[model samples]
Target: MRNLDLTTLRSFVAVAEQGGVTRAAAALNLTQSAVSMQLKRLEELLGQDLLDRSNRRIALTNSGELLLTYARRLVELNDEAVGRLTDDVYEGELILGAPYDVIYPVVPQVLKRFNALCPRVKVQLRSSTSLKLLESLRRGEVDLILTTEEAPGQGGETLTEMPLRWVGAQGGLSWKRKPLKLAFCNVCIFRAGVLRKLDDAGIEWEMAVDSDDDRSVEALISADLAVGALLEDSVPPQLEAIQSCGALPDLGIQKINMYGADSRKEVLGELADMLRQGFAASRGPVAVPKALTA
Candidate 1:
């Protein structure tokens, strides 16, 4: 009986998802020729043309569509089987630190999935500003940390760049008021961008709340006390992204990054992959960022 290569299926899936071979190659950390070769080999094995390349963009043939469905299932099942079979029975405590903003919504999902994969590993979470989290990592108080870079290309393994936007209370006119009232942490990455832009735009601003607790900042915004800046996706339901409020500077994008004392730890590696996967699922199939690939 002929056998199918899981590696070929993976390459096909990457090509399909990325919408082109070049991007798929970059995403897979494979050369263009290598990806093309994988696809060619897979097509040859099945005795069918999987992709229709008549136009500038490639589309899937009828057979390719059918194969994609099975490919995805096969890949998922194979991954599950491998994980179940090869996973080390690990028992240890992992200390994870991240900004309060990341703790909500995002990190929780990562933790839930990680717990399922490594039930014996206990994760102790610490929430603070990115600056504080970095300090904790440096001081050997935390095993791993997720943080936003203060400047472009500054620190940690960058996962992805997230847009920073101004957020204010729902149905509130706080953004319209001059001398903007802001609520953010003292060491927040967005704070400097917010301040710099506001200054450049000739808009006056004051810190209505300066706490590292994201809940406190949310509370301030919910009460219409001040506008805050946060990653566009991380903005809570109580707050609405305020982009058109006049003279507000574009806060730009910040890199979401991970830092750890030891990336080689079994538990930490798995947890990091889970975190990256969670974030990637939200943003579409993302290549594990280069820094963490090692």
Candidate 2:
């Protein structure tokens, strides 16, 4: 009956995600009473109960679940519209997210160029694992993200498929008889694919080191502690691809992609073109830095 407020919808989504008033309050940086009052106001306006609050934990009612889905879409659309109108001057903040490995190699140059083109724009960068970055995107926290594509079910468009290669300290370890000393990120798609291939080949191997951080894995490989798989374009300067590994049986290559809410299609489209150009320029016929070459 009454027009819903955007702030109330945001609060509702936060509560749904956190599953309790206290937690939701903490996440939204609002007092528990304030959050509860907003939830109550939302339910009153909608003329239906959103959550079943009889229990300790908040459980979304069927209506709440439906509203939660629509609420996220609505918020995304609202934010995109606001950003577009405000961004005509290219003077507002653009929050971008990507894996450190991808961004560290060429993003500085990309940002430098982007800033020169849109000097008034303020750019903010956040680096994290692909999964975490995607979560941030869905939460409406990031304007755009660059990440590796997984199987078809995973969200995001496939921009480029670059080869994956095994790299380790130069001349430090030989793979003749020893099970390869492997280093990898815990949930890395590239690492998972590599491990799967190794299992299928019946290659005796053990994880000499594991971390969720890319820098840590790179450090291990650089120190000759273990071998690691990386995008052909992202191998570090201190390491060399292991010739014995022999092209890694394809590992299906790693895909780089861009993602944002559909409502931000205009902004995402412009951003995507810029990224495609950057990737092509970096990976094209012109030579890239040795650190970036496979």
Number of the top TM-score candidate: 1
Model number with the top lDDT: 1
Off by over 4 Å in 2: 1-88, 104-106, 150-155, 245-250, 261-268, 288-294
User: What are the per-residue Cα lDDT tens digits for candidate 2 across 89-116?
Assistant: 5665778898877885457756754654
The TM-score between candidate 2 and the true structure equals: 0.61
The global C-alpha lDDT for each of the candidates, from Candidate 1 onward, is 0.75, 0.69
RMSD of model 1, in Å?
6.0
lDDT of 1 at 59: 75
Per-residue lDDT of candidate 1, residues 190-273 (tens digit): 777678888888888888985767678789899998988888777788889986745677788787788873467877887887
For model 2, the run of ten residues with the poorest summed lDDT:
285-294
Error of 1 at 205 (Å): 1.8
